[model samples]
Target chain A: MIAHAIFFYTFSIIAVVSAIMVTASKNTVHSVFFLILDFISISCLFIMIGAEFLGMIMLIVYVGAVAVLFLFVVMMLNVAQQKNQWFAGQQSSRHIPVGLIISTLIFFEIIIVIGGWKYKPEIFDINNSISQASISNTHSLGQILYTDYIHVFQISGMILLVAMVGAIVLTFRQRSGVKRQSYIKQISRERAEGVEVLEVQSNKGVKLDD
Target chain B: MEYLSAVFQEVYKILFLLVPVLVSVAMIVWLDRRVWAFVQKRQGPNVVGPFGLLQSLADALKYIFKEIIIPSSSNKVIFILAPIVTMTLALIAWAVIPFSATQVLADINVGILYLFAVSSLGVYGIIMGGWASNSKYPFLGAIRSAAQMVSYEVSIGVIIINVLLCVGSLNLNDIVIAQKNMWFVIPLFPMFVIFFISALAETNRPPFDLPEAEAELVAGYQTEYSGMMYAMFWLGEYANILLMCAMGAILFLGGWMSPIDVYPFTLVPGAIWLILKILLLFILFALVKAIVPRYRYDQLMRLGWKVFLPLSLTWVVLTASYLFYFNLLPVN
Candidate 1:
């Protein structure tokens, strides 16, 4: 229990600090790196808490794939040179108070929800307690994911498929001047298309231009 | 007192495992070079220690003595951190990899996923290196690597899911034990091929090593690195390759188990079999590097997205249906 508490605190602190750095960093590239760190630390926390499958998935999907995508775009666009203007702009002062108020409200709302949950823990599972001693985390997750939430799982997959198609359609382009290899045309080429028996009859008068 | 002893024991185990792993990295590097050289009809590193046994140690010493040059324009912190991240991730992934039924650093329940996750994160080192270098070529190389790894990861994920369907457990030991009857490669031959190919691409090995394509990118993300820093990348990369080979062994080749369960084969310990399998896989990797030509960029993308994606996805469906039909599906 002591070891668990120590690990939880360490990872949570790292996660929080890195999450802050993700937004607070000046360089966009640095921000992306911080984002990755945040994901990693949070995943570490998840693993420590026994949701090993979820932790690994979070690391794979978010830190590994998504954050790398963010880094790729940031490097490609060369946005690291952009001076952070969050505090520099004179007009930013007007919106600062508004931001503060909104953030505070959200913070209180979270605290209230946590407090209520702490007082009435049964609100979370009034009906079913899914976790069991016999099955491993992966096994139980698979059971619930593929059985009771099967429709939701399928729908989420369809959503991803649609999003993929939509992204392809949006970004895909065709250029007229570019020369591309046509495998079909190359494979289908025939000797009759270019060679002729009467070709040398009159080299100059063979109407080569035609 | 008991807690202190347990902690000490854990540390001892870690050190015990890590030293051999580090040494194996050296051997693998030497072996890879020798194998590649042999394929091309040449002798490789014959002078180091009577047939190049000490070549890796010599190289390590040279790297240690060399100067680490941090490019002035590069982000100093990240440039250093990148290689460390790569090496750390590579080493940590082994914590979950089972050498035998009993030998492992951590016998986690989600061992396969943990491996998958670590392998996927391998791209960050390249990306971070490329971006931190602040050079055009390295940046380009980093982007290519990032995209390549991400694309291959999708197909790899699908392939692993197909394997898990057969084993019914995510534990590496369980996967290997389940294969006692028959290796997964025999039944899931196509998926095995896809997984191997994907692993090659994931590790940025030859034919798919566009990130470091010397003809174009000029060493890719390692263009700016020097001395020990560069050596670290080399070590990390070979470590990753070995890890992938181990992964292949455990997932499909019955891991540490002998090929035939009878007689002489069974007399040998499981760890020896695992080592043999890894060596065989490494030789195959080297052979591919020597024999296969580098793929064109567009063709690589076409293979990953158009060809592999659909093929692996179809196999996943087929595997599931077959399992369900035969009532062979593992009930949790």
Candidate 2:
């Protein structure tokens, strides 16, 4: 219980700090980094909720891959570095108070919603399974995925498949003069049956070892 | 007062573990250097403190006192946070890793998943460090790392699933205990190899060290980092390597269990065996890094996506079959 509390408070602090920094930070890179921290906190929250699978997935997807991707894009663009290249107009500054007010209102609304809701965590304790229930979360998840959520699963899969196809299409660039590897032709290479060992004969008649 | 005491205790334990790791990192660095020296026919840091034991420490101290030069154009906040994230995540992953019986921070049921999560978080350091550098090479390096991590992560997951199907638990302790009779290495050799290789690629160790390949990327994502900032990356990297090797030992070599028998062998503690196994794997990794050349960018992607992914996925299917046929996995 103590461990849980420590983990909770630590991650919550991280989340709040990082979230504030994400908006307040001047540098876009800093903002993106704080976003990564926010994702981490959310992942910790998942773990605290006894959703280890979700936590792991969140880390693997968000921290390992997506956040990195964001950082890479940001770095490649060098938006922060481009600050000197462009003048900081008063346009954004003028809207700051209103943006802050709206954002804070929404944030407080979320806090209220969460604080108002209460449920017995023990009631949904995954460990408190009946003997007939699945062994682990993975087992239970797989069961639901294949049975109760089958259609939803299929639809999600389809969407991901489409996204994959779309990504391929977007990235595919055919330059007029560039050569591409012919995988089919390469795979079809046949070794001839009349494979005579070619004796390399220099004027001195040097035999190469097989 | 009680809470304060608990916190203090936690801090003390953390410090104790951390000091050893930091020292071990130094030792590993020294050992690896010496090995590389022999391989290359050159004297390594033998001149410093009788076989250069203090060299890594000296270098660390040197970095400690050096100036932290944040580039004017760079994001100071993220740049600073990047290395900390990297180092912190690496250290935290050690929490679930059991060295011996009853010697773990928290023996969580989902220890394996915790490992995955923490290791995954490690990429952020590289990404943030790169992005905050405000350099083109670093940016490209970060891009490569992101793509590589994602591609290899899928394979790693599949391999982990294969292990899980056989072990029937996500708990690291349970998995290790399952291997008490016979090491999982022999039966699950293929998965072991796949996992090890994926781990190598995941941690960005050579020949999978494309993210920081010097010839092309020019120190890659950490181009701008110098002094302790750079040292943090180095330390974080070596720590990750040890963590991976420790994990591999736990997963395959019966963890702290001696190879001999069911009855506890009085000859050596399991922790020693675990450490020795880890050391051996660490040496193998370091050796491979020293000898093997880095893979081309395209080749890396092809191998991770086209080859390793399919192989691991197929193994997952095979494992499922083996479990079903043998009725090993717990099922309704």
Candidate 3:
């Protein structure tokens, strides 16, 4: 138990620090790297807490796919080296007070919620919940995901499908200037259509364009 | 004190495992060169040790002694951090990889998913390196790598879902154990092939190696990297290739299980069998590299998005429904 608590504190500290660095970093690329570190540390926390499947999934989804996408966009745009000037512009300075006020409100709300919440001893009692030792986290997740929450699962799938189609529709374009090979057209051409035999071409130069 | 001792024991186990893996990776480099040379009818490195067995060691020594160059315009911090990230991610993924029934360092439930996630995240290394170089070729190479990895990753994910459907488990051990009667390759041959090809693309192996195309990109993302930094990418790439091969073996070829599992076959240990399978897959990877030509950029994208995406998606649907219809899915 002591070891677990030690590891939890260590990983959480790393996670929190990195999460702060993500926004505080001057370079956009460094921000992405900090975001990755944050994800990794949080995933470590997840793994330590026994939700190994969810932890690994979080790593794969956030660090692997999403973070790489962020890195790709940042690099492609060539904007990583820009100096981060917070409240540099006169107009930008006007929003600083509003941002601070909102953040303080959120901080107070979180504090209040935590302070007011009461933890019942029964919540920690294992006898009331499913036996964790008998089944892996993934097994239980699958059981509930497919059987009880099947509709929600299907809806999420639909949402992903819609997002994919929308992305393709938005970015896909056909240009008239570009020349592309049409394999069907090339393969379908017949000798009669492609070649013309003229009797007068033996004595005189053939009029190619005609 | 007891917990401290336990942690030390784990660290010791890790060191031992790491030693063998590091040695194997070195040997794999030498083997790849020799095999490729043999295929091309040329002599490879032969002066180091007997039969050039220590060529990779010599190369490592040379790299260690060489000067590490930092490009003047490059992002100095990220340029160094990129390879470290690459190497660390490559090594950490092995934590959940099972060599046998009990050889895994961490027998997590989502072992396969962890591997997938780590492999997918590999793109960040290339992107970071390329971007930090602040050069045209590396940037282009990084973009190519990012797109290629992302495209292939989608199919690989779907293919893994197909395998998981048959096994009904995400645990690597369970996936292997479920194949006791018949390896998945026999039933899911097309998925096996598709997964293998996708793995090749994911690892940026030849035929799909447009990211680091030598003739065009001039070392691609590694353009500005030198000495030890460059060597780290080499180590990470081979490690990833080996991991992919191990994954292929575990998923489709029944991992450590003997092929026939009768008489003489059952006499051997499971770990040895797993090693043999990995070696075979490595040979296949090398052979393909030697034999195939590099793919054009558009052709590679077409193969991934057009050919593989639909095929793997269709297979996923077919696999799920077939398992349901025949009631052949493994019970949890």
Report the error of model 3 at residue A95, Å. 4.7
lDDT of 3 by residue, A1-210 (tens): 887888899999999999899888777778888898899899998888788888888988888788888877775554623453442435567878999999999999987666555455454444423346898888777777898789999999999999999999999999889999776798999999988888675668767785
Better of 1 and 2 by DockQ: 1
DockQ of 2: 0.49
The sequence of per-residue lDDT tens digits that candidate 2 reaches over residues B137-200 is 8878887887888788788778778778878778899888888677888988988888888889
- Candidate 2 or 1, higher lDDT: 1
| Interface CA RMSD, all predictions | 0.8, 2.2, 1.2
* Candidate 3 iRMSD in angstroms: 1.2
Cα deviation at B98, candidate 3, in Å, is: 2.0
Best by lDDT: 1
* lDDT, ranked from best to worst: 1, 3, 2
- Here, model 3's chain A TM-score works out at 0.73
Number of the top-ranking candidate, with TM-score as the measure = 1
Candidate 1 local lDDT, B147-250, one digit each (tens): 99999999999999999999898889999999999999999999899999998999999989999999999999999999999999999999999999999998
Query: What is the lDDT for B216 in model 2?
Result: 93
In candidate 3, stretches whose alpha carbon ends up further than 4 angstroms from where it belongs are A78-87, A94-131, A183-210
